[model samples]
Target chain A: MAATYELIYWPGAPGRGEHIRLALEEAGASYSDTARLDAQKCADIVWAQMSDNNLGDKNTSPPYAPPILKDGDLLISQTPNILMYLGQRLGLVPSTPEENDIYKINALVLTALDGLSNEVHDCHHPIAKELYYEEQKTEALRRSKEFIKTRLPKFLAYFEKVLKGEASGNGPWLYGGTFTYADLVLFQICLFQPQTDSQNLASSVYRKRDGVREKS
Target chain B: MAATYELIYWPGAPGRGEHIRLALEEAGASYSDTARLDAQKCADIVWAQMSDNNLGDKNTSPPYAPPILKDGDLLISQTPNILMYLGQRLGLVPSTPEENDIYKINALVLTALDGLSNEVHDCHHPIAKELYYEEQKTEALRRSKEFIKTRLPKFLAYFEKVLKGEASGNGPWLYGGTFTYADLVLFQICLFQPQTDSQNLASSVYRKRDGVREKS
Candidate 1:
């Protein structure tokens, strides 16, 4: 029997998990999502499967975290890897080596989105998640400021270059000719709320000043 | 004229860049590494090529960071993408879909290495690099402890399953028979000081704990 595609992710926070959801939704693949309230519940399920100690089962890989995709006996995790798997499976990626190069470029941009997410998460919990955000407000402010000024522009510009460099010369989308998982992640990251008014202003100002902009 | 592979990375920090270097070395591909003493020197060279106003050669796509690989006319970034690209080119990845599925599994493990690197960096600078580690000592300690106790085991256990689950019954390596880039990254991550210490204890403890465990 063919295994069904089951996706396990956090139900509440739409963070990294959205990447997997978007890919599956776009592919129109049949899959189930197990979103628990907390990490404990998620970890419990993962630990239980890993405890099985059976090496032969095709789908029994232990997931390190949520946003794992299970196909019958095959368990796979990692957002980029899941996207790449589905991209190829669903024909979202390109066929030729040259075309696949573009797919890779798009994939790379999506990884940058992960970096951006890390920065965003760090803002609220600059010191550590173990410590409350309130306790690290001052440090968070500085970190958020640096992220807005330096990191955000660098990432956005790279995507803009990708957009401009597309051989197809189309409007919007990273690959230009096709809509890949990269575009979805780009849209998601660009839409995330900035930590402060000034951070938001900085981003907008740079976009406008540079004359290469995306509408939020 | 063919464009030679030119890799630009910080000379001292064999951090993320080492992954690319190792893949290229393993493939025996001809390449050059342009490293700098400090971030300032590195930025100068990167920005010089990146300056939009210059636009000397429109054919070249500028990469946003180091470990960028230029093959012929193509310039690629992001470590895993580069590895995947090389995997296909060097015949390290399997040609068939079933084989590709295994390749994807290995790629996900490499991506996890990237995640682990970020956590390691965070341990040293938990409160943002803008603040000195001296200021965030308490937070760093807490995060580092959590990483050692929780994250390391989860990642290692996943890889162990991948190794054990190999259909060919391979020894040590994650995939069937050969050492993919995934193995290189895994080996690198395992060598990290903290992980090395914990891994020793894990092997001893889990050896005893394995028999009693049950499936989820």
Candidate 2:
């Protein structure tokens, strides 16, 4: 029997886990989405499997957080890592060396999306998650502004180059002629900005500067 | 003519950039390490070229940050992205579907390293980089403790599975036999922790862990 894929991620917010869901959805793969496993249940599993004292005769793999994928006996974690694993299985990645590099680039784009998510989380919790976003609103605003002015443009321009580069051939997608995981992630980034008040800031920069278009 | 790999990173601290450097060194590739490019130099060449306003007609890929790899017409960024690119080129990665998944797993390990680095940076500037470490010392202490107790084991156990799992039999390296960029990154992570204060805390929780012996 073929290995079944089990995706474990938080229930709501469609955050990082959404990227994996998008890929699986696009591929029409037969997978189980266990949305929002009880936080305590998840924490208990993590502690039982990952605790230092429990290291005897156990499976050894370091998964920092969820959005992990289990295919038969193979359990993998990390967002881009999981995506890359799925990209290959789903034919989302290319075949040849040159084409494979494009897939690698797409994975990097997804990794950047992860970085952006971290930044967003930080915006509301600049001090610490231990404290409420209300406690850090002033600091969050300052940091958010810097992120808008500096970081957002830096990341956006990077993708624009991928879109316009020779590899893309003036194509709409970041890779070859077809859309890949990179496109999914780019779409997600654009979708997420509005929730964080970064949409307006990005639009102003992208608009004032002609030649770049929002496709998806 | 072969294109020399040009790497741009901050001058002194290895930080994120070191992972790229280690891969290049292990591959025995000829490359230039350009560091300490201040705001002016960054503007004159790095930032200007990467910016949309200055991209002009150049067909090169844009890099989001330092440790970018410039190979002929191709310019790649993000540490794990660069390593994945180099891993294939240098034959550090295997050439089978299963092996390729292992390579992807190795890249994921690097991603974990990146996350750990972020946490370490937060230890000093927990609230925000805008504030001094002294201001957020209390919060940093709490966050750092959580990281040591919970995060370290979670990450290490994942690696232990990859190491012990019968992907290629219980072997030394991450992908079984070969020493890929992942191993280099794993080594770097171990080295970096001591430089920061994380070593002392992580040791108590993760010192006797399995599969960690290979890393040692």
Worst 10 residues of 1 chain A by lDDT: A207-216
Question: How does each model score on lDDT?
Answer: 0.59, 0.60
Clashing pairs in model 1, backbone N/Cα/C closer than 3 A:
A48-B216, A58-A73, A59-A73, A59-A74
DockQ of 2: 0.26
For residues B35-150, write the lDDT of model 2, one tens digit per residue: 64664564455555555654323333445555667776677766777777777787666554354455344545555565556666766765555667787677678667766765
Query: Model 1: chain B TM-score vs. truth?
Result: 0.74
DockQ for every model comes to 0.27, 0.26
- The 10 consecutive residues of candidate 2 chain B with the worst lDDT sum are B202-211
Docking class of 2: acceptable
Pick out the ten consecutive residues of candidate 2 chain A with the lowest summed lDDT: A207-216
Q: Best-fitting candidate, measured by DockQ?
A: 1
Tens digits of lDDT, candidate 1, B129-216: 5567897787688667777677666665655565566442343445554555665566565554443565763452233123212210
Task: Kindly report which residue stretches of model 2 are placed more than 4 angstroms away from their true locations once superposed.
Answer: A1-4, A36-62, A91-97, A127-150, A153-172, A192-216, B1-4, B36-45, B54-60, B91-98, B101-104, B124-178, B192-216
